[model samples]
Target: MKAKVFIMIMLFVLFLVGCDSEEEVDRKVQDHIMETYGFEVDITYRESLNEGNMGDRIYQVQRKDDPKVEFTVDLMGMWETKIAGDNYEIQEEAFFIGEKFVKKYENELSKLKISNVVFRKSSGLYIETSYNSTISNFKEETLQPLMEFINLLNSYKESEKFEDNYAELDINYSNDKSVQLTQIHEIKTLGQLKEQLYQDLDISNESLKAKDEELFIELENDLRKLGYQYEYGLNSDDPRFESFGCFQEFYENGECNEGYRMYLKGDSLEKDKIFELIQFLNSHSSLIFQDVIISNSKDERIIFEDIKLIKSMADIDTVYSGVNESLGKTILN
Candidate 1:
C-alpha cells in the first residue's frame, strides 16, 4: 500500500510539470510571429567572459528565411570591467535585441531599420523584453538613441572630410519605453571629433570658420582636424591648381559624391584681391567666363573666349571694320 501511494504521488508531480512546460508557449508564439509578421527568426542566448572581463549574456539571433540577417545583443547586468571600460553598468534592468533578429524585417520592417531607432541606457535599470511583430512599429522618438548612433557611425564612415576611427555604444531600455530622465554615457576618440568636423561641414558649410586666404590653409585645417595631412602639386606655375585634399577618407549619405571644380583668374598682387573678383562675377548672372586671356598687345582689345567660339561677334567685328573702311558709302549698305 505504501508503494502504491508513492507511485500515485510521482505521477501527480509529472502531470504538474507537463502543464507548465514553456515549449507549448514557445511554439504558439513562434507560429503567431510568422503568421502576423511574415518573417522567421531563431533566438539563442550566450554567456562569455575572458580573464580580464566580466561575464556577459549575449542574445544572438538569425533570420531563418534570410541568410544575410544576423545580430547580437550583450547584457552587462551589474558586470563591470575596468580594463574594458566601466561606463556601461546598468543598475536598472536592460534588454538588447541582436542585429540578426532585427534584420529579418529589412525593407519590410520600417521600424527595424537602423535609420529608425535610437538606443540609450542608464545604469541600475532592470531589463526584460522580447521581440515580436510589435517591434516593427516602434516610433521615431522611441528609436532615437539607436538611430542617432547608427547615423553618427554611418555619416562618419562615409564622410571624406572626417576620420574612420570612432567609438560605438549600442543600448536598449528594459522598460519598453524611452525616458528622458536618465543618465547615459558615451565615449569617442579625437579622430571621430575630426570626422565630425568634416560631417558638420556637409551639414552646413556656413558654420566653417577658416581663413579662405589660401586653399592650402583651409585644406590643412580640414585634414589636421581629421588626423591627416597632405602635399600640394609640383607644378606651381600650371594653368590649373587642386584646391584641397579630402580631410577624412570616408563618405556618407548625401555626401559630395561628385567632384567640384572652382576656377581662378585675374592679375592681382594679393589672393584676397583675386577672391573679390571671383565673388563679384558670381554675384552677377550675366557674366560667365571659363578662361581669361591676358592681352599683351598694346591695342588692349578684350576678346571673350565665348565670342570667339561662336564667331558671331567676330563676324560683327569684321562687318563693322569694313563699314568703317568704306566710310558710310551707300554702295556698302
Candidate 2:
C-alpha cells in the first residue's frame, strides 16, 4: 500500500512539471524584453480555452522603469488531447507607449519636412536654419573651405576701407537631377577679389594678359587638329584679357549653328587652360556645360553660375536626409 502511495505521488509531481504555466511564459518574455531594451519589465499572461481545446494567451508587458510604456504579445495554442497536447504558437506581437503605437513613435523624423537651408559664408558659418523652430550648426571640420570663405567675408566686414561685396545667390531645390543656381556679384568687388587672388598667385595683370593671348593660339591649334574652325574675339566693352571668348560654328545639314563657345577667366590662364583641357577630354563621357554659365559675355553682367556648385548643394540635401534617418533610429526608435 505504501508502494502504491509513492507511485501516485511521483505521477502527480510529473504531471505538474509537464503543464506549461502562465508564470513560466511571463518570465521568458520579461527576460527577453530586459535583454533587448536594457529595461526591466513585468509580464502578465492570461489564457482562454475554446470548444476544441484551442485557446489564445495574451501577455501584457509593462516597463518597470516607466509603467506608462507597455506592450502585448498574443500566443495561440491547440491541444491534440486534454492533458497531453499543449502546442503553443505565437499569434501576434505588438508594442505601445501610452496610447501611441511603438513603431509609429520610433520613426517620427520620417514625417519631417526639410524646407530650406541658409548658407552663410562669413567666418566659415554653415547653419541649417530653423525647421520647426530648431536650428542646427554644422561641424566646422567638415566645411573648412566654406568657413574660411565666410571668415574672409567677416574680416572684410570689419574693415572700413574694404568695400562690401554685394552678392545674391538663387538656389532652386529640385526632386530630380535638374537643379538651377544663379549667383550675382558686385562688379567692383568681383574685380577686387580677382586681383587679390592673382596677387596671391604672384602673376601680374600684364603677364596674365600675355599668357592668355598664348593660350588662345594653342586653343585654336588644338581645335584645328580636332577638325574644327574657331573664331576668337574680345568683348570690346570689357577689354580685359579675361573677357576673351571663342565661338565655333559647325555646318550640319546645311544649317549653321553655334557648336561650342568656350571662355577662360581667373588669375592664371595656365590654370584655366588645364581645367578646360581636362573638361574637353571628358566632354564626350559627360555633359560638359549642363546649365552652367562659366563667364559673363558682357561687362554689364557680373554673374558666375556653376553646375558643380549645384551638385555640392545637392550633396548637402543628401546629408540632411541622412540626419533625419539617424534621428528617427536613435531618438524615436
How many residue pairs clash in all the candidates, one count each? 35, 6
lDDT (tens digit, per residue) of candidate 2 on 1-333? 999999999987875675556555556555666555677756544445453545455566556774334445555543311222111111011111111221322233123322233332222222221223211111222123222333333443345233323233222222221111122222234333332323221122222334355554665466445433222243233334333322212322211122222443222222233244334533533223222122212321111122232233333333234543321111111
Model 2: per-residue Cα lDDT at residue 74: 52
Error of 1 at 248 (Å): 36
Provide the overall lDDT of each model, using Cα atoms, as 2-decimal numbers. 0.32, 0.34
Query: Which window of ten consecutive residues has the lowest lDDT sum in model 2?
Result: 89-98
lDDT of 2 at 99: 19
Q: Which is the leading candidate under TM-score?
A: 1
Prediction 1 global C-alpha lDDT: 0.32
